[model samples]
Target: MKGILSGFLVVVHLMVISQTSPTDFLFPAPPNQKELTSQKLWSTQYYIHQFQSGGKIPIVYADGKPSGLFADTCDFCMASLEGTAFVKDSSGNSTIINFAKSGDSSFVNCRACKRFAASKLNVESWGRTLWSKSQGFGDGVKNYRLVPFRTIAVDKEVIPYGTVLYIPAARGKKILLPDGEEAVHDGYFFAGDTGGAIKKNHIDIFTGIYEGNPFPEVIKSNENKTVDAFIITDQTIVDALAGLHLKKAF
Candidate 1:
């Protein structure tokens, strides 16, 4: 019986490492090789929250009274979408601000009062709902909150949300995590966010903005570059990475 149990454990370990889809049974049947390998094809790009200090647009109250300036147009664009921006204060210190869309007016939360004119920033900021306050910036689809360096947006039809992926090209990259810790990429990424542009054969990596823009630069160097990717079948590893990503920290 002990020998039989040891054999069972070995089979389980092999199953976990072999990239079995979650839908598979405990003793999964063999997969179609072509279908399985097809998921390996990936085109990688990255997205970032805006962090411009030299912004040209002014964030103002609904009445058109000036409140603060955005870092730049790209900063304004991403801030509206991502729900967060790093703004330059009077003393030239960068500060974090949050935005939420409400009808014709958008609410800018940080240094100013709640109601802000959408007309000032233009029409692009009109449709998004308020960002989750508890999420620090914004939440992803469902319960998957966005994590700066750890989250990747995928076509849900291809790679389901909560799936764990391994990218060989990103394996040894080093990054400064949000909590100010320097960490090495384990090559594991969580599929937590989605975008309209994220269709088949593509994955959008979320490399959150930082003051110095250091970590983003590291990820940017690899942007638009294709790399071999694998879905991790190991439930233990998937759960660990997914849980960390949902916690909204690296």
Candidate 2:
């Protein structure tokens, strides 16, 4: 009886341990938890663009008329930070001075969400190639479609554009400055509004219901969705045209 009772107790202990242990598949342990923090020197938001459909050619505007050619979306729509004022009272009380001046620090317009010509044509060509090799070009190429997309703004300095970044939660400790000495944030950038709950080094991404168009819909649905992103930046590369403009425009 004693031996049997002891075996039963061991089995119960094992069961409890198994239940309490963290599952490897569901919640994998992070590589370095101590290296992550939220302190940041400069925090700002930028836009994000996501592609959905393929095949429809984007219309271009020339003199307020349709130019019948494709135009890169980001070429026209620009994103920038907004200026704000902070006020304090004589009694050591502080408050936001103005609300009207608070504007959307990060945003993208309709023109900035259009499809690229290269991507559209490349997809079409690939479909034709695949069809010709397998079944027949006529049947396969008929369904070819141009890809469409939507974009939002995130932080620019923290997550460099054109690099894939993953946000673990809607909020988490971002790994900024690997050494963890100075104030900085490293992780995915998220879009935030002027009046929203924004921390010094945190971001707030937007998501909402919209038209059935897959392009824009995907971007909207991505709110709270953990994803690895490849961000791009316009300031990283050196361009002769930009240098000339800088000298001439000023």
Candidate 3:
């Protein structure tokens, strides 16, 4: 009778252990506990690339093949820090233009769409490139494909790449989705890209593309605002948010 009673207790213990969730032990809550702390908040600015159309700005490859069409005002902006552009032709088709360098000159390339012809109506040439390794088409440091709204250029020394962060102030803000539908901001951001101007305690938000106003109003509102920020160390939540950007990114 005593042996049978001990056996029953052992079986029950095993059943309890087996039924327990593995994640409960495997993934523990982060130190910050997902709460925004005053120490984590940082000043932030915004950056954007544009999908320009119906302009007289012309760009070509190093070989003089017409690359794509860009907005008239995009000449200097496209050559600046935001090293990429989405140019649209008269037919309303779009192509990616990445900045490149040839010796002492800067240029742009339509590596994605190579068949476009220059608009002959006195269009201004942005630059010319032959596609060399001296330049690239992505972010400043890691060259990770920039995803608008989700990507941020951070100071790597302060916020390393792959670190997921949450901005409490961004919560409930509405943003336009890729499908043209409006979605509320989740306050989540991924630090996958970096920039020269990004320094300690500063972050540059990538707001994707726009025609008139480069920075969206939602993002512009946060400019220069020292908002509450949180470092998400929880692997589960990190994967769900950060993975969403990395998986879709190149």
Highest lDDT scorer = 1
Query: lDDT scores for all predictions?
Result: 0.50, 0.23, 0.49
TM-score of 1: 0.54
The Cα RMSD of model 1 versus the native structure comes to 15.1
Measured with C-alpha atoms, the lDDT of residue 52 in candidate 1 is 34
Give one digit per residue, the lDDT tens place, for model 3 in 122-207: 11223332221121123434434555566777888988888777665665566653334465666667787765556776777765
Candidate 2 residue-wise lDDT at 241: 16
The count of backbone overlaps in candidate 3 is: 1
What lDDT does model 3 reach?
0.49
Q: What is the TM-score of each candidate against the true structure?
A: 0.54, 0.20, 0.57
Residue lDDT tens for model 2, 1-250? 1233333333323322111111111222234434534232222222211121122332222123332222223322211111111112233222211112212222223223444333322222111110011110001011211000111223444532222222333122322211112221223332223222233333333211111222221233333432333322223221311221121222
Residue 102 of model 1 has an lDDT of 39
Question: Per TM-score, what order, best first?
Answer: 3, 1, 2
> Cα deviation in Å at residue 111, candidate 2?
17
Q: Least lDDT summed over 10 consecutive residues: which range in candidate 2?
A: 131-140
Candidate 1 lDDT tens digits, 38-65:
3544444343343434545555533444
Runs in model 2 deviating more than 4 A are 1-29, 37-152, 162-166, 171-250
